[model samples]
Target: MRPLIIFILFYLLCIQVQAKTLQKTVNENTISFDYTWQDHSHKTQTLSFSLPKKLINNKYRRFKRYDKDKAMNHIYKALLEQASSYNPREVRVQFKQQYSQLSYTIKSKSEKKINEVEQKLKQLENKTYLDFLKQHHYIEFNTPWAGTKIKPDHKNFVIEGVDYLEPVTQAIRESISVKKPRVLINFVLSWLQSIPYSTLESRTESSGLGYYPPIRVIAQNIGDCDSKMTLMSAIIKKIYPRLSQSLIYLPQHALIGFQLPTLKTDKYTTINGLHYILAEPVGPAKYPLSEIADSSIGYIDAKSYFHEII
Candidate 1:
């Protein structure tokens, strides 16, 4: 009786990406488990699973495995579907066992339409977007960590305020001798830059802005890709935004493309040929969306997997 009660309680905590974790205690042929559930849905749910003194799972039936979140979800859905058929007005469930009869309750909210379940699923998915970006090379880099900048396509990119960007090629003219690639500051600048990354966690409104300048960006250093690209276009409007091939890549090898752009870039006009100056992030390079990624690991791209204008 106690084991049966435990099975039912353990099943409830398996939903919403919570893993179905079970612990088993053994004595002779009997196996008893007190499955403790935590780390999901904001509560502690526990139950005990016991097998008949003789029937043990030593047969290696991995289907009985419980660590999988998917399996936990399946168990949860099964429990809910089974529970739904019981009419609260018609029946009451109570059990007596030495381990103590623990009661389970399905809150009124759980009985809501399937759409509510979908909403919960969406919330879980939404929580994963930024994490996804961090695990993939979502942004692209043009050159290796240490290399001369590649000349881009011919075109002028636009800047709303700055009419004409004085062009300057990347030249190590000042330092004819490259430093022997010494590790400056005990680690990479990424560890020390204190660069702030952001998303629309809190925004009053959103809309389209055609073109902007770097002054605001230099000042606030915050804005969406819309303004980011707009500023990129403005800076390089005199150049071109290449469509066929990636305009940039890192020594590690990566790429992305801009359509035709037209701009006042810090460098030569028409760098993109269509005037779209490079719109890469001021700090870290973002990978293109085409790349397969898992943000459960740390990777980055300006392109968002969640959804975006570009």
Candidate 2:
């Protein structure tokens, strides 16, 4: 798995007043939200969405922070249970603990027992690790070349987030009042840009301050660059599942790009012979599709950034 590295790139722009047109109404079983933001053309755009109270109250949306030690301990417990199934007289299971790490050793008078335990442990390790990540709504990703990292499970996140966010796309359709592809995308981008910005610490080292799943971005009302990008990707994917997308990572920031026809002035990167028009959803400063922040432009122009397609 490749770890998606994150850097905290700060901008001097003002945090847009997100509460200007915010409205929320709760019923017996659901919470309905309404928000408004100005598009690039200075026209006001409004969208409303409702989510089940039970869904929001569930364990997943409530907890955004990840604990590495706790995860390892969970895996260790599962392995212990698997290893203990064998006869202790012939098979011995040992552990060495140092801080957050837990290492294990399996010994036996019979070489076959050792092999059996080893093989079983391998299976258990993969199973338990995948289970923990899935349960926690996290994904272990690999870098393009060779490396592993952790991030939220983008695919599953999109699948679940799309249901509750259906209204978002619908409202977008209503706001535009037509099926103009470019205007539709820009509308979504501007709306996301209007959301107040939050910072994520080093993604490699920690989940940081405000890395949220797509639903939480709506429920909690804040997200960093990567968090917002993921939410936007999910929304766009729901609208156009066949559209190709990528997550472009810079020194301390992240962006989402779409593969589509482009004008000469549009900023894009070519990957595998496909062109992805880069868009900056991290805002208070609005930019439409085929454009990104000046800072992002620098990294891309220098060929110092990398991307992971979704």
RMSD score of candidate 1 (Å)? 27.3
Can you tell me which runs of candidate 1 are displaced by over 4 Å?
1-164, 167-196, 200-205, 208-213, 239-256, 259-310
Compose the digit string of candidate 1's lDDT tens values, residues 82-155: 45565665432232223322223333334453444445544544444323322221221133243322121111
lDDT of each: 0.29, 0.78
- TM-scores vs. true structure, each candidate: 0.22, 0.86
Residue 260's lDDT in candidate 1: 31
RMSD of each: 27.3, 7.0
Q: Write the per-residue lDDT of candidate 2 for residues 1-310, one digit (tens) a residue.
A: 3333222222212323545656778999998888877888888878887778887777255656567887889989998887777788889898776898888898888899889888988888889888988888787765543357777666677667767677677766776666766777888899888888887666665743357878778877778888898889888887887888888876578888898899999999888899899999888788989878787887777767667677
Candidate 2: misplaced stretches above 4 Å? 1-16, 143-147, 302-306
